[model samples]
Target: HIVAAKYNIRYIISGGNFATEGILPKCWHYNAKDITYFKYIQKTFGNKKIKNFPLFGFLQEMYHKLVKKMKIIYLLNYIPYSKNEAMEILTNELDWRYYGGKHYESKYTGFIQSYYLFNKFAIDYRRATFASQICAGAVTRTQALKELEKPPYDESKAQLEKEYIAKKLGISLDEFEKIIHSPAKWYRHYPNNEKWLSFIYDTYRRLFKKEKLGNF
Candidate 1:
């Protein structure tokens, strides 16, 4: 907010693409912004203290919105969009290249999106992404299913990425493998402000009589 105020900015723009948002399975989704829960997990599971990592809880978010007037906007939600066309433009104009799958441009995102979630939770988030694309008329159900028939990522590359990530984190390959094969835990297992957040959201939604996207 201070930065925005300095620049005389009226609003903040975000890339929260509707086509790619809220498609993940609810069970696998955790509110990472819950700093209390994040700290608890870090202390319990993380090997080292991670400092200066910014996180915002429900109250902080409300402060930003209502007090700071830093209204972050997702413009994509207000209009029809074509991810294919956008990608094409980005490719031709900026010389950007596709890295096989969505959100595969970065090693961190790629590992989580393609590897960790897939191996640990046995959840194919791609299916949800494909379903979202289908709803947007970007692809047929058959096309999506055919794509899903094969592995979401190249086996060799995924293995390399896993090893690289484990090495970078100073963990042994065996430790990484053990973590993957271990039982998956949900967000409810940890302390969180999810219930409070949910209650507020539900109350507001009910008062406004707004329909959620999933309900449709």
Candidate 2:
């Protein structure tokens, strides 16, 4: 908001394509064009040294609840092509390279999402994503369940990635392992104004009709 005010940019546009994906499965697919658009937008208007703001982080998780019921067809307008189709087009026309998994372009992110989240927290995001695809008629439930049963990362590659990450962070592999084994903490563990924020949000919701408040 401060950045927008400084730049006199009135509209806060987001490619919130995941809004319909949450409620309906068929809208779950993402393609290379999505990545291209994101890169283009970032190059055009994104901050070079972005600070991690707590309010922005808080809003990311909470805002989805406000748009959970958005129609799938409307969201489809944002994603007109399939993943495979986009890949083919990008590879052929733009010589765009492919990374294996979601957010895998970043080594740290790839390690955390593919290895750390699963190994430490037992949280397999692939299961949820595959299940969503199943719901969207993109894949069979059996296929998704079978895929879930398999490990997310290859053991040899994961070890190499782990070593690379630990080295990059200037931490011993042993220390990294201990950190990974430590119990996970929730957002409430840190100091924040979420309670007051929630209270105010709820009060506003109560003053207005539920539908008007986008609570559905």
Candidate 3:
């Protein structure tokens, strides 16, 4: 029904969740052979013990192929750790210039490198974008192109012309994050705010905030 809505309609974009199960698809899935390749990277890069697949196969193939061709051996070694650790390092700063842990540790930061490969050179770019999330360093090349032809959601750029109660009430980013994270908080924090009531009645919001979250 939302898809059938006409021109100039506004919509909220949900974050691409990486959890194993949810309304969103699974974070990762790729070919079986690709898993073996990641294992190789794990051993050579971080010398860590890989417990499970970091991402699914379809997500892996795009960067995996590039890593193969470029002989990018460093990130492969860190495959033993969870995706969270890998992402933190990639998103944050890691000294790839000098190798402290291993000789190849400086080869590639997983997130940045993956973006470089996927955003720049995948054959089925749209398919790759749909398969992986941005935190995995996967940028949607096709979506970026489409936004060129149409108005893109200016989430980061959006300025509230009218002072929101949430903002005027002097809400901090952390507090706002907390409210959005849990259903209970929505009502608990903003009982007088009609938005919270509307959210509680909305079927989608009810489903999304079913569980009460204590921590992010």
Candidate 4:
């Protein structure tokens, strides 16, 4: 929003779609707009005081949209999107390179999706993507299952990568191990507006829009 305001941009495009993210369970992700929840986590875990963070509270959220006249445009919904074809285009046009798996656009995201999520909560991110892709006709069920049959990484290689990441974060291997093995907590355990937000969403959909996230 800050960047948009600076550049006088009014509309933003969202890549969210049924083809890639439609099957991921809501529990796997948190609302980016949940300022209270964000502050709570940062205050509880961070060492420094939060300052000038680019976020808006629930009340201020409307000011950005209604007052600033900002709008969101979801492009994939109106177009025929094929991941395979898109990847081919990217590879050919931009010289883009394919990594090991989906959402492997960066090593950090790749590690979190492939290793961290599974290690912390037993959530296989690939399963969500694969299922969504199958439903969207991006890939067949057999193909997705075959990919799932293979492990994200060899045990030895995974450990090495973990050790390297620990070093990069300036933490000892034991510390990183403890951090990873620590008890996993659900997002709802902390402060949130999920209930109110859900009510608001249902109300808005009832009064205006007919589509629902759960319907996907």
Sorted by lDDT (best first), the order is 4, 1, 2, 3
- Write candidate 4's Cα lDDT for 1-216 as tens digits: 657867989998888777887786878887667777888899997767768665676556666676888877889978878878988999999999888675667666777778877888888888998898888888899998998898765566678778888887778999888988999998889998777777766776787666886721
Give the better candidate number (1 or 3) by lDDT.
1
lDDT per residue for candidate 1 within 96-215, as digits (tens), equals: 988878687878788887789888887887888888888878889999999989887788887788898899888998999998899998878888777776786677568868676442
Displacement of the residue 196 alpha carbon in candidate 2, Å: 2.3
Judging by lDDT against the true structure, name the best candidate: 4
lDDT of 1: 0.77
> Higher-TM-score candidate among 1 and 2?
1
Candidate number that wins on lDDT, 3 or 4:
4
| Candidate 3 per-residue lDDT over residues 117-182, each given as its tens digit | 233322222243334433344435565356345322223322231124236536665564454344
Error of 4 at 77 (Å): 2.1
Writing each residue's lDDT as its tens digit, candidate 2 over 1-216 gives: 445444654445553343223332222222222333334445564545334422333243243334332111334436642555667998999999998775688988888877898887676668766655655566787887888777887777887898999998778899888889999754344344545555656765677543332221
lDDT of 3 at 54: 46
lDDT of each candidate versus the true structure: 0.77, 0.58, 0.35, 0.79
By the lDDT metric, which is better: model 1 or model 2? Answer: 1
How many steric overlaps does candidate 4 have? 0
